[model samples]
Target chain A: MGAIYKRELSGYFNSAIGYVVLAVYYFFSGLFFYLYCFYRDSASLGYVFANMFYIVMFIIPVLTMKTFSEERRQKTDQALLTSPVSLTEIVLGKFLGAFTIYALCCAIFLVYGVVISFFAQPQWSVVLCTLLGMLLLGMAIIAMNIFISSLTESMVVAAVVGMAAGLVIDTMSSFSKLVPIPWVQFVLEKIDFLNYYTNFTYGILSIVDVIFFLSVTGLFLFFTVRVLERRRWS
Target chain B: MIEVKNLTKRYGKITALDNISFTVDTGEVLGFLGPNGAGKSTTMNIITGYISSTSGTVTVDGSEILEEPKKTKQKIGYLPEIPPLYIDMTVRKYLEFMFDLKRVKLPKKEHLDEVMRLVGLEQHGARLIKNLSKGYRQRVGFAQALLGNPPVIILDEPTVGLDPKQIIEIRKLIKSLGKKHTVIFSSHVLSEISAACDRIIIIADGKIIADAKTDELSGVLTDKRQLLLTAEGSAADIQNELKKIPDVQKVKKTGESDGAAQFAIEYKPGADIRRDVFSAMTRLQCPILEMRSGSESLEELYLRLTGSVKGGEA
Candidate 1:
């Protein structure tokens, strides 16, 4: 597992893709930090992290496009799958590798928060909550991308599907008004991934929100394992 | 040791393997010979636990692959048709990753040296797999399978595209590896299997048609008890003279060269006619320059064996 993780992490930065992901992530994240602080004249970093959650819908795919898809495209999945290592380890190693890059992008958010404090008063507790929210959001996005990556050998298809899936989960809350049935709208409202982070961005740590993100991540990873396991039998 | 019993794999209606059963004793090299799309790879895949058989069981040592896939797979190393290489990775890194992949633990720094030495990749270890030649890349794949010293090594077409020199090198390597590992390599080439495998299993249309020692298989397919003799005589004289011998089913003048004649003598089924031919030539005062038996070769045997498919009874 460690070997796969190391190889995957190195693979990201071996070409321009990793640097591009980090550059674009930090560039836009810094741009938002500047806007939320200087343009809007706000000292709270929660708004910056909140907007970053939306950025994840677009950026996470870049980090995960080649996670499993490229392995299949290059025909290397035969080696990994035929190895004695269990399927769970293969899935989790890829997840953590992509998550590491996401975490690296979030690291810039910390610098953003630190830079914000230099200019005005900002609570460290809310900053911590925002950091936690950023990670949870990124984890959920990574899991979804890993699952999509497993479904095809084409990296383009994986990226497009992953981006579209994220948009689906992110925008699920907006469709609530269109639903004619009250129960349907209620379910839609509860299904929003971003809604879980609203409390954390407001410095509210709801146990339900933590469980939701973790469960979503776990569910997708479990599905990815099952998909690979099924290939051997069929 | 491996035991496969009534092993079958079906893709909806197409049966990739039809109740194929074979057993390999400890330290035996079994060659699986089959044409394309003939279930050679499918059977290897199932035996290695990379895939499951639709109905039936594969047992390695004593544990069933379906019941303990991880443990059973640890006992085998498989190299599929394509040497599953990560092109972006260096040869060293690929081997390192495979070591972890095979769940083999060694001293942090010693595993690489061991594998490189075994596969003779010590110098090319630092090169990217994409940069290495095809032969070296295949050696890297073989080195990956050699990691942890697994008892059973399954190679699918190990010398598919290699040059003659490299082919000989790989054949020698497999022959030496056969000394210790229970190796099962599949190939469409007949001479390769005869040279490297102790036992050969020929499959056609998803069934094991013949399974026996390589030499024994050759014996069963060749029919002979007659001899071709070089005699100084006219064609009519030799034919009329040889016809008088008993058990001579047919005798014809085959060809003439060097002012001597060659006669192809065929004996009756289950009859030894060499003694009669020699004695008749001696009595006729004709010198017998040479005599040789006409028999089937291994290549002909292979063609005859795999050419026939099972009847479509199902």
Candidate 2:
């Protein structure tokens, strides 16, 4: 697991993907900070966090599109599968490899928080809560996108499908309003990802919301492992 | 060192391997000989635990592959049909990653350097795999299989794209590896198998058609003995004289050179008709120039066993 994680993490930097992901992520975060906090003469990070939904959706797929799909496409999965490592370890190694990059991207927000602190007393509780929210959301999305990557050999197809799935999940509540049936609408609103994330943005670290994100992450990771195991039989 | 029993694999409606079973003893080089799509890769894949068999089990060193994958996989090294290399990594880094992935306990630097030297990749270790040629990529793959020094090594067509010189070098490497490891090598080329393996398993259409010692396979397949004779005489006289031997089943005039007639004589398997033919030629005042016994070559045996020959020509 450690070996795979190290190789995968280095693989991102070996190409331009790691640096590009960081650059794009930092650029968007800086833009949102400038427009929402610096230009507005306010120190609140809530507006910046609230507007990051689309950026997170777009960036997570790019971060994870090559996790397993590249391995499958290059036939490198044979070496990993035939090695002494278990399937669970391989999946976790890949998940954490991408998660580490996303975590680095999130760290930029801490820098922004420090910069805001120089001029005014920013709300530390809200800032930490929103950061936790972003990390948890990233965990679930990375797991889900990694699962999508495992289903196909083409990295392009993985990225496209991953983006599509993220968009639908992120906008489930808005789509729920369009449904005529009350029960279906109620269920979609209940499962809406943004609804759970709203609590963290308002300085409320709800246990139920944390569990929801963790469960989603675990469920998708389990599904990824099963998909890889099923491919052997295939 | 390895045993496969009642192994069967099916890709949907297609049966890739049909109840094929074989075993390799310790310190033996076993070759899987077949044409393309003959379940050679399928069997190796199952043994290496890269894929699962539909209804079968592979036991390596007394541990079942599926039930105890890590334990069994630790005991064997596999080189698949495609060498499973990361193109972005330098040869040294790629091998080091494999070393760590396999969890080998040996001294990493010395072991990797020795493997690189073994496969003639010592000079190319610092180069990226993407810049290396196909033969060099194959050598890197071969070096990976030798990393942990596992007791059992399974290679699927290890010399597919190499030139003739490199092919011979790989063959020699396999021969040397057999001394320390139980090697299961698969190849579609007939001479490659015959030259390297102690025992050969001929698979065709998802079935094991023939399994015998390399030399004994050819011996067992030659049921009808043939003798080639060249005598200093007219073709008609040599043909007529050859017909007088009772054991001679059929005789055909092949060619003539320097007033010598060449005749191919097919005799019953148990009979020794050389002395009779020599005496007949001596009685006819014809000196026998060349005479040699001919058995079915490995190529003919492979062709016949794989059902490529038609009308019993083999």
Candidate 3:
């Protein structure tokens, strides 16, 4: 697992995808930071994070799309599957590899909060909670995309399907608004990831929301391992 | 040692492998000979635990592959037909990654250098694998399979697209590795298997048609006799005389040069007509220049057993 983790991490930087993802993420994120904080004279970092979450919906797939598809396309999976490493290790190593890059990009956004604090008295605890929420959101989305990559050999298919899935998850809050039923609306609110994310944006660190994100991430990672193991039988 | 028993695999309606079984002892090289789509790759995939068999078992070193995959996989090194290389990585880095993948207990600092030297990749260690020639990439594949010094090596078409020189080099490498490890390699090339392997398993349509020593496969498949005769006579006269011999199946006028007619005499099963042919040539007053008895070559035997050619009375 350690060896695979190291190799996959280096693979991202060795190619152009990693840098492209970072540049796109910061470019849009810095733009939102300027518009929300400077142009509108608002000190609340939550608005910037709320808008950045939508941008991440598209960018995380770029990081995770080639995780397994490229290996399968090049036939390198032969070397990997025949090795002594277990299926769990292979899946976990890739998840962590993509997660590391996502975390690094999100960490850079900490500068936005620090810069806001110098000019106006922003809520540091609110910023911290929002950052934690952003990390969880990224984790859940990255894990799901990794699973999608395992399903196909074409990188384009993985990316497109992953973007579709991310789009549905990111916009589920709006989806709840379109449904007017009281009971269905209640369930969709529970299932809507953005509603859960909204609580952290206001400095509410609910344990239920944290477990919800972790559970979604774990479910996808587990599914990815099963998909790989099932391939041996097929 | 490796043992496969009653192995069967089916992809939907198609049965890829049909209850095939074989064993390879320690220090033995087994060649899997078959035509295209003959379940050669399927059998290898099951043994390496890369895929699962629908039923039956494969055990390596007394442990079942599915039951104890880590131990079984650690003992075997597999090179699929495609070589399974990361083209972006340098040769040295690839080997280091393999060492970790195999979970080698020894430090890989000097061991990798030694493997590089073994596969003749010492000079190309710093180069990316994609930049190297096909032959060099093949050598890198061999180098990775030889890493961790596993006790069993399974190669699938290790010399498919190589030039003659590269083919011979890879064959020699496989031959040397067979001295210590149990090796099983698959190929459709008859002469390659006949030259490199100790035992041969011939499969056609997912069934084992013949399994014997390298020298015995021809003898097992063919029982007819072919005699080449060179006699100083006219082609018509020689043909007439050869036809008189009993049990002669087909006699073809092979060549004629300098008042000599060469004919190939194929005999029916259970017929040793050499004595009759000799006496008939002597009575015709034609001097016999050369006479040699031979069986069918391995190539012909392969074609016949694979159902590409129809078999005769024997």
Candidate 4:
């Protein structure tokens, strides 16, 4: 698992994907930071956090698209699967590799927060809470995208499907409002990931929301493992 | 040692491997001879735990592969039909990654250097795999399988795309490795198998058609031995004289060249009729120019067993 993790993490940087992902992420986040904080002359990061939700959803699939898809396309999965490692280890190693990159992207927000601190005293607790929420949300989405990547050999298909799935998860609450059926609305509200995410932006660190994101992350990682195992059987 | 029993693999309605069972004893070079789509790679995949067998078990070193994959996989090194390579990585880095992935206990730098040297990749270590030729990439794959020095090395068509020189080098390496490791090498080439393996298993249509020692497979498949004789004499006289020798089942004038007759003599197996033929030729005053014994070549035997050629004894 350690070896796979190291290889995967370095793989992102070996090609242009890692730098490209970070660059795209930083450009958007920097633009949002300037618009929400500096141009407006405010210390609040709530608007930047809220607006970057959709950007995170779109950008993360780029990081996770080639996780398993490239390996399958190149037939490198034979080496990983046939090695003396379990399915769990391979899945987790890949998950953590992607997660580390996403975490680095999120860490840029800290520098943004520190910059705001010099101009005006910001709510550190609220800022920390939003960062935690962003990390958890990124974890869940990265895990889900890795699962998408595992289902196909085409990285393009994985990215498109991953973005579609992310859009679905992010917009469930809005879709629920449009639905007239009360039961469907209630179910969508119950499963909406954005609802849980919105709480942390306002400094509400609910344990239930944390658990919800963690469960989703774990569930998708499990699904990725199952997909690999099923391929072997097939 | 490896033991595969009752192995059957089916992809939907198509059966790839059909109830095949075989075992490789310790320190044996077992060549899996088969034509394309003959379950050679499928069988290797199952034994190496890359895939699961539908209705059978593969036991490596004492444990079932499916039940204890880590333990079983540790003892076997597999090179699939396509060398699974990361072309973006340098050859050295790729090998180092594999060494770590296999968790070798040997000193890392020395072991990797030895493997690179063994595969003749020492000079190309720093080059990206994408830039190397096909033969070099294959050597890198071979080096990967040799990383941990596992007891069982299973290579599926290791010399498929190599040039004649590289192929000979790899065959020699495999022959040398057979001295210590139990090797299962698969190929469609008949001479490659006959030259490198101690025992041969010929598979066709997912069935074991022939299995015997390298020298014995021809004798096992062919019931008659033939000798081609060229002599300066009348064809009729040569055939008549050759038929008089005991165990000479049939003698036919095959051809005439430079006014010399070429007679093909079919004899019973295990019979030495050369001395009798020589004496008869001296008595008939038909001076012998050339005489050579012929058995079924491995190529002919392979074609016959694979059902490529029909209605003739190999």
Candidate 5:
């Protein structure tokens, strides 16, 4: 697992993918950070994170597109699958490598929080909770996208499918608002990931929201492992 | 040692392998021979635990592969039809990664040096695998398979794309490895198996059509030999004279040539009619000028079995 993790991390830097993702992500994120907080004179970091979550609809595809699709397309999966390592190690290694880059990007959000502290008193605990929420959100997206990547051999298809899936997950309830019953609406609202993050911006670390994010992430990663294993039997 | 029992693999309606079973004893190099798309690769993939068989099982050294995949896989090294390589990595780094993947117990520093030297990749170790030539990439794949010194090595078409020099180099390497390991490798080339393996398994249409020791395969499949004769007589006289010998099945007279009649004599199954013909010709005083027997070659036998062979150059 360590060997695969190191190789995947190095692969990210060598292909310039890690840098490209960070640059594109930060450019848009910094733009929103400046627009909502600095120029507008607002104390809400929630705006920056909310917009960043949407921004992942675009850039996360770029980061995770080649994770497993390129390996299959280039026929490198043969080397990986024939090795003695268990399937779990291969999936976990890739997940951590991708998540590491994501955590690095999310850490940069700390600069926004620190810069805000110079002005009116900022809530450090809320910023910490929001960062944790952001990490969980990114984990869930990475898990979901890795599964999409494993399904196709074309990088373009993987990237496009990832973006589409992210769009549906993020905007799913906006369309599902057509449901009539209040109970149905309540259940559908739970599916809206951004709706859960509303608690973190106000300094309340909602347990249900944390559990929801972690469960979604776990479910997708579990499916990704199954998808790879299914190929062997097929 | 390996034993495959009633192993079958089906991709939907197409059965890639149809209940094929065979066993290789310890220290035996079993040659897997088949025409294109003959399920040889599928069988190897199942045996190596790269894929699951739809039905039946593979046992290596008394351990069932599916039940104890990690332990069974630990003892096997597999190279698929295409050499599996990480083109982005340097040869040295790839080998190091494979060492970890195979869970090699030896220290990396020691095993890396030995494997690099074994596959003759020391000079080219620093180069990215994508930049290396096809033949070198193949060697690195082979080196990774040999990293842990597994008891069983299954190589698919190892020499397919190599130049003549590289082909001889790899065949020699496989031969040397066979001295210690139970090697089950596949090829469409008849001469390669005839030269390298203790036994050969011939597969066709997803079935074990022929399986025998290398010499025995040739002996069973192509035992017939034709004898050519020239004599100072009419064609009918030579034909009549040749048929009187025991075990001589057919005698056909072509035409008179160069003041002698030419006749072709064929022997019955497992028969040696040369001595009988020699004595009969000497007694008749017909003055035999020449005699030739048909040869049973691996090429001829392969052609006879597969039927699509065109002079065997490919």
Candidate 6:
């Protein structure tokens, strides 16, 4: 598992995709920081972190589009799958590989938080909470994309589907608003990732919210392992 | 040793492997001979724990692949049809990754060096796999499989895309590996199987049609023995003289060159009329210039067995 993790992480940096994803992610992140903080004279960094979710929606797909699809296409999965490693280990290794890259981009967001502190002394607690929220949200989304990546051989298909799935999850809050039934709307809003993420921007750290994010991440990783196991039988 | 029992695999409505069973003793080189879409790869995949069978079990050294996959897989190294190489990495990096993936606990440097040397990739370890030629990439894939020195090695079409020289070299490497490990390789080419394997399992249409020693398979497919004799005589006179030999069922004139007639003398089952034919040819004034027997080569038998749709099972 450690070997697969290292190989997968190195694979991203060895190609142009890693650099391109980071550059595109930070460009928008910097742009959003400028628009929400400097140009508008806002002291709080919540808007910058909040808007960053939109950028994450796009970058997560690129981060995960080739996780398993490329291996299958190149026939390299045979080496990994036939090895002594269990299916759970293979799934976890790949999930962590993509998460590390996502985390690097998030780490850059922390630098932005520091730069903002030098200017306006934004609330440290709020910034930390939002950073935690961003990671949880990103972890769950990355897990979902890895599962999508495992289902196809073409990277394009994985990317497109991942992007679509991300968009659907991100917009679930508004989609729930359109529902007429109060109880149904309540359930959807509770499950909507944006609803859970919005709380951290205001320094809201409910145990339920953390559990929700963790559960989503765990559920998707488990599903990914099941899908891979099912492939062996198929 | 590897043991497979009644392994059957199905894809929706079609059965890919139909109740197939075979075993490979330790340190034996076994060949899976079959045409395309004949379930050769499917069986290899099952044995290596890369996939599961629909209704059967594969055991490696008494560990069931499904129940104890990690233990069974640790005992096997599989090279699928296409060399599964991460093209971006150098050969050395790729091998090191494989060692780690296979959980090799010993010192990595020495084992990797030995594997690289064995596969003739010692000097090219620094080059990225994408930059290497196909033959070199294949060698790297072969080198990856040998990393942990597993007890069982499964290669699916190991020489499919190599040049003639590389093919021969890979065959020799496989033969050498057989000295210490149980090897099972699949190929549709009869000559490759016959040359490299001690036992051949001939499969057609998802079923094992024949399984025996290389020479014995030819004997099983052939019911009658034949001799090709070139005699310096008229075609009709040579045919009549050859017909006079007892147990000679049919004598046909196949060709005539320079006034010498080539006759195919087919004998009844379990008959050796070579000396009698020679004496009769001497008496008939038809000097026998050339004599060749055992007309049924493994190649012909393979064609005969696989060509027929109703090719019987062994």
* Residue B234 lDDT, candidate 2, scale 0-100: 84
lDDT of 3 at A109: 63
Error of 3 at B11 (Å): 0.6
What TM-score would every model get versus the actual structure? 0.86, 0.88, 0.88, 0.89, 0.85, 0.88
Query: If both were scored by TM-score, which would come out higher, candidate 1 or candidate 5?
Result: 1
Model 5 chain A — which ten-residue stretch has the worst lDDT? Answer: A194-203
Cα RMSD for candidates in order: 5.7, 4.6, 4.6, 4.2, 5.9, 4.4
Compared with the true structure, what per-residue lDDT tens digits does model 2 show for residues B22-66?
999999999999889989999999999999999988999999999
Per-residue lDDT of candidate 6, residues B1-314 (tens digit): 98999999998899999999988899999999988898999999888887889999898989998888888899998899988899999999999999999998779999999999999999998999999998998899899888789999999999887899999999999999999999999998877887788889988777888888877864665576889999898888778877888899988777899989888788887888999998988888888899989566555666676664353322
lDDT of each residue in A114-134, candidate 5, tens digit only: 888889766788889888988
Q: What's the lDDT of the predicted structure labeled candidate 2?
A: 0.93
> Which candidate comes out best when scored by lDDT?
2
lDDT of 4 by residue, A1-234 (tens): 999999888899989988988998899999999998999998989999988899899988999999999999999999998899999999999999999988899899899989998989989999999999999999999999999999999999999998999889877988999999999999999889899999999999999999999999999999999999999989
* Reference-based lDDT, residue A174, model 6: 86
Error of 2 at B238 (Å): 11
Candidate 2 vs candidate 6: which has greater DockQ?
6
Error of 4 at A97 (Å): 0.5
B308 Cα displacement, candidate 5 (Å): 12
Where does model 1 exceed 4 Å of error? B221-303, B306-314
DockQ each candidate and list the results.
0.56, 0.70, 0.69, 0.66, 0.47, 0.72
Model 3 error, position A192 (Å): 1.4
Docking verdict class for candidate 5: acceptable
* Better structure of 1 and 2 per TM-score: 2
Candidate 4's C-alpha runs over 4 A off are B221-299, B306-314
Q: What lDDT tens digits, residue by residue, belong to model 1 across residues A85-139? A: 7899999988998899888988886786678788887787888887888789889
Model 6 lDDT on a 0 to 1 scale:
0.88
Clashing pairs in 6: none
